[model samples]
Target: MKWTEVQEIAIQLSERHPETDPAKVNFVDLMKWTMALPEFDDDPKHCGERVLEAIQQAWIDEVA
Candidate 1:
């Protein structure tokens, strides 16, 4: 999945990190975790602050 797949990424992240809280995640960790996904395929440089924020927000929403 690409950076555009924010919701999907968030869902996967939430599922993988059930013990962690989304709001507590920093962008650096977020980036690392997202990149670690087997389905994730994209340039790391494509992840800007806005995209990271969107992913984090989606993750928070997903957990809620």
Candidate 2:
């Protein structure tokens, strides 16, 4: 999926790491994990703080 696919990414993250709390994830690790997702394919340079924030927020929603 693309960087704009926030919910999809969150779902992947949630499923991949069901034991972790998305709210506590740091951008450094978050970005790393997102890149590692099997469906993920994009330039790392495209991600910014706002994109990370959206991913984190979506993850929070996903888990809640």
Candidate 3:
């Protein structure tokens, strides 16, 4: 998934790391985990703080 697919990525992340808390994740780790997803295919350069923040928020919402 691309960086634009924020919600999908968040869902995947939440599932991949059920024990982890999105709110406690730093952008560096968040970006790394996002890139590690098997379905993720976007360029690393395409991701930014805004996109990471959106993914983090979505992940938090997914768990909540």
Candidate 4:
């Protein structure tokens, strides 16, 4: 998933880390984990704070 696929990425993250709280995740770890997803394939340079924030919010929504 690309950085632009915020919801998809959040779904994957929620499934992969069910025990974790998306609201508590910092951007650094968030980016690292996103990059670690098997379906993820994109340039790290393409990601930014806004992308991470969207992903985190989506993940929180997914969990909620």
Query: Which regions of candidate 3 fall more than 4 Å away from where they truly are?
Result: none
After the best TM-score superposition of candidate 4, give how far the Cα of residue 45 lies from its true spot, in angstroms: 0.3
lDDT of 3 by residue, 1-64 (tens): 8999999999999999999989999999999999999999989999999999999999999999
Tell me the spans in candidate 1 whose CA falls farther than 4 Å from its real position: none
What is the per-residue lDDT of model 1 for residues 7-62, given as tens digits with 9 covering 90 to 100? Answer: 99999999999999999999999999999999999999999999999999999999
Q: Count the backbone clashes (under 3 Å) in each candidate.
A: 0, 0, 0, 0
Residue by residue across 1-64, what tens digits does model 2's lDDT show? Answer: 9899999999999999999999999999999999999999999999999999999999999999
Model 3: number of backbone collisions:
0
Q: Rate the local accuracy (lDDT) of all candidates.
A: 0.97, 0.97, 0.96, 0.97
Candidate 4: residue 24 lDDT (0-100): 99
Task: Name the runs in model 2 displaced over 4 angstroms.
Answer: none
Model 3 — which ten-residue stretch has the worst lDDT?
A: 39-48
Candidate 4: which stretches are off by over 4 Å?
Answer: none
Q: How high is each candidate's TM-score? A: 0.98, 0.98, 0.97, 0.98
- How far residue 3's Cα lies from its native spot in candidate 4, in Å, is 0.5
lDDT of 1: 0.97
**Candidate number with the higher lDDT (2 or 3):** 2
